[model samples]
Target: MDDRRGSVLVLTNLHDVTTDIVLRVLAARRVPVVRLDPGTDLLAEASLSASYGTGGQRGTLRTPSRDLDLTRVRSVWVRRPSAYDGPPGLDEHDRRFAREQAFWGIGGVLASLPHAHYVNHLWNNRAAEYKPAQLAAAQQVGLLVPDTLITHAAQEAREFVACHGSGVVYKPLWNSPYRVAGRPHSVWVREVREQEITEAVAVCPHLFQARVDKAFDVRVTAVGPWLSGVRIDSPDLDWRRRQGLMRCEPVDVPGAIDQSVRAYLAHFRLVYGAFDFAVTHDGTWYFLECNPNGQWAWQPPDVTDAIAQALADQLEKGSAP
Candidate 1:
């Protein structure tokens, strides 16, 4: 009965390959899609107007080339938060302040739409991105979780490693993108040697975990009520560290695992997620983490096709697809 309904909204970076595949599927399916990349679009003549009162907030987003009524949007897929940069010629401090302003200003409005079925909503994605929260939810759903600790004290880290006789691994609190010598750098998950826990640990909080003796990695991509999984086998500690070197095969997820995954998604209020598990030789699936809006375009051919089709279905059919 609503007159303001409109196209599906996708918030993602321009270079996201998964977004590209899904967009193509939506195009072939004749589903209306509005793509917004905050990094490039937010400041370049993108407009938003929201009204606040007793009935709550209602608004419209206007790009230079199109208009989207917030109340009309079928669904929103927040793939990633873009970089907000200040205008040219500002000092470092002033630039940061301006970027902050841009982030809150435009981002706040997008986050306030009155009627929309977001695949992984911004607020929910933010919460589920935390590893601790994910692990807690996994345990509650009867999934085995590795013993974990988040600390900055070297002594505490050493003690944790000693207590966890199976040995321990170190992971970044978050995979924050940065650069070194003007080139991109990243922190990959790797095992920790007791002697390597040095004074540098005091620099910031670090995540340490008991290493799971794994047979392989399982990546399950959940799209609404449907689920598909792939087993990853590689010589590297983190298969993603050497993407092309890893072998991927379709996995038949057990009913129990499927139910627990559904539970995890419900706990985070997400319609889509990429769940990672470490499978032991004994067939135990150890929960590692979940990416609310993970990459899928690079998966094997059949997996990619299924994912794209699933996303296209969701966009075309709205809440039920």
Candidate 2:
């Protein structure tokens, strides 16, 4: 089969503007694309029938717009798709059972698609999401990593903060959706003092790191062999909170940082990554966490377009097998 003739299967929710950018690029190039949300589509707006034998696995997935031949998928872009919620109406117990089936059944099929190139394979994305794993990988690749500690003990948290006399910051291991008083809440990076450590720290594992007295933050978005570095200038500790007040400009990636970025991606077998770095006054690039499936559409227009084009190029080329 000619891989180029196959369609690009996009797995993302309807409101994902990032996926929309890439889809537009694909459409402009006349690449066949089939976009669907497994969460809401499977068992509702979509249907599937797959089989396996001596000839290998084959199936047909019917989405609202198109019927995708599982064997003819050139690549899959696993974007921010919600979890399988099962069918619309069901009892709690039945819903749980149906969700599980949808996940392992249809999810497994999507993961097993032969000769399909995944931007960042779902398994790889899962492993890279671990902060511990990411930090270890960055250090192994010769990147400058700040002193860090992960603990569930109050005493340990206090000691960590005390030892880093310069300062320490608490960062959540994962950005799980949080709510306060019926309103969405975000946990931003904030300086933590030794005195602030309380017995509540023992209730859960918390991450603390020596804060880098940085000049600004750098967001490097990598797609395959392409890398786009953006210098973000903001007065706040976390620029994301006040993006409108921040200044963004395209910057050249340092040779060493570029090499380390590629090595880090190779370590996790990821074709895409959004790496964060804290650059100090002395021009040191301190390694921060890399979001394996991070958002890049929020970047400046030119950078976003470049990333979209690069991603589309990868999907169009598919994978060599």
* lDDT winner: 2
Q: For model 2, how does the per-residue alpha-carbon lDDT over 52-156 read when each residue is reduced to its tens digit?
A: 999888999997787889989999999988889977679999999999998988888888898899987888999999999999999999899999999999998
Show where candidate 1 strays beyond 4 Å.
2-5, 53-57, 319-321
Name the best candidate (by TM-score).
2
Tens-digit per-residue lDDT, 178-206, candidate 1: 79999998778999988899989999999
| TM-score, predicted candidate 1 vs. hidden true structure | 0.93
User: What TM-score, to 2 decimals, does candidate 2 have?
Assistant: 0.98
Judged by lDDT against the true structure, how good is candidate 2?
A: 0.92
Model 2 Cα RMSD, Å?
A: 1.0
Candidate 1: what lDDT? 0.85
Displacement of residue 133 (Cα, Å) in model 1 is 1.0
TM-score of each: 0.93, 0.98
Residue pairs in steric clash, candidate 1? 5-72, 6-72
